[model samples]
Target: MKALYQYIKVIIQAFSSLLNGLLLTLKYFLTPGKSIITEQYPENRTTSIRIPERFAGELVLPHNENNEHKCTACTLCQLSCPNGSIEIFSKTIETEDGKKKKILDRWVYHLDMCTFCGQCVDACPSDAIQMKNNFELSAFDRNTLTRQLNRPDSRLEESNKQQKNTLAS
Candidate 1:
């Protein structure tokens, strides 16, 4: 008799659970076009689609209007990359006062190998690199994904030098 009672209790519980699900479905069916969680991706691409600011999409080196960047060729970003996605090539040059200075020659970023962890951006002391919100990273050729972050003939910004000097003094 206890076994039969237990079986009946389980049936009642199952029926209650089923009724709850059905009620939820009926509520959703009645309230059409309200509180929609589905986002039509491709159709809304150019319109109402919103991407969060914290989304780690693409790594980029921002250049000023004068085509100058903030990278000091410190290699901190390269070292912070876990997958070796960032490769920086720097060269030593002599200043006007004959002081040997290290400058950035190239800043290569391999988008294919990157995990979008944003550690490289965080490690940069000069704030040279940052993650942009552009997520369309698909490419037909793999070589295209291997990008140079710095623009051609770009140099370090003069404002960066002034800020460093002020901070030092």
Candidate 2:
């Protein structure tokens, strides 16, 4: 009972000291036009917040000259994904040259399940795939997050044309 009385007294004294300090701080804070250390939540946005070109966020395949995705349907990326986020359905495609080549039949990716570890990017033999810096991935539906990226028939030729025009200019 005596120890309890002492503890209560100590606690009361500490609380009194804390209150005095807090009141002093609050006095300054209440002053008109006092500088605020924190900004309002999420009201500010600017172009400077963009990630650098080297900052990796998600992986995707580049396209070839024929407007086709460069993914050889190797399945290396699919196998390397830690969370099974990548699913590739591939089949043989015969070009005009009569050469059989692996092409993606279906490219299903669950971004919600992905950890973005970049293991799949490291495992790719072809310079076909790389991590892109698009991070605005919040979604309403989980099913819609199962995205289809780098369709087999991509507009690679248009990209090349744009590149050529940029180079020429």
Candidate 3:
């Protein structure tokens, strides 16, 4: 009798689980307009479809109107990268006061090797880098995926220069 009771209990639990799943399916079927989970990418590509702000689509180093960036060549982002996707090359130059300081030369970003993990952005103390929502990253050639974040001849931002001057003094 105990064995039969145990078997019946198991069957009832299984049936309950099945019923719950079926109910969920029925609810979704009945409320198709409310249960939109997937976006029609091709059709909605040019539409006003909004990508969420938190989406880590592409890493970018933003520049100001003067073509200046805030990277101080601190190497914190490079050190924190788990996949070695970010390579920073800095050059030391003497400031007006003859103080030698390091500045960003080339910020090579290997998009092919990147896992879209925002660890590098979070590790940066200077807030030099951030992830942008422009996710059209498909490339025909692999070499095109490798990008340099800092533009040629770009220097540090004016505010950062002021901060450095204050710290130097």
Query: Which candidate, 2 or 3, has the higher lDDT?
Result: 3
User: Model 3: per-residue lDDT, tens digit, 99-165?
Assistant: 7888888999999999988999999877999999988999999999999999999999878877766
List runs of model 1 lying over 4 Å from the truth: 1-26, 162-169
Candidate 3's C-alpha runs over 4 A off are: 1-19, 30-38, 46-48, 95-97, 165-169
Candidate 2 lDDT over residue span 93-140, tens digit each: 686989675556777778888898988888876555788987777788
Q: Which candidate number would show the highest lDDT if scored against the true structure?
A: 1
Best model per TM-score: 1
Please tell me which model should have the higher TM-score, number 1 or number 2: 1
Q: After the best TM-score superposition of candidate 2, give how far the Cα of residue 121 lies from its true spot, in angstroms.
A: 0.7
lDDT of each: 0.92, 0.73, 0.91
Span of ten consecutive residues with least summed lDDT in model 1: 160-169
TM-score of 1: 0.79
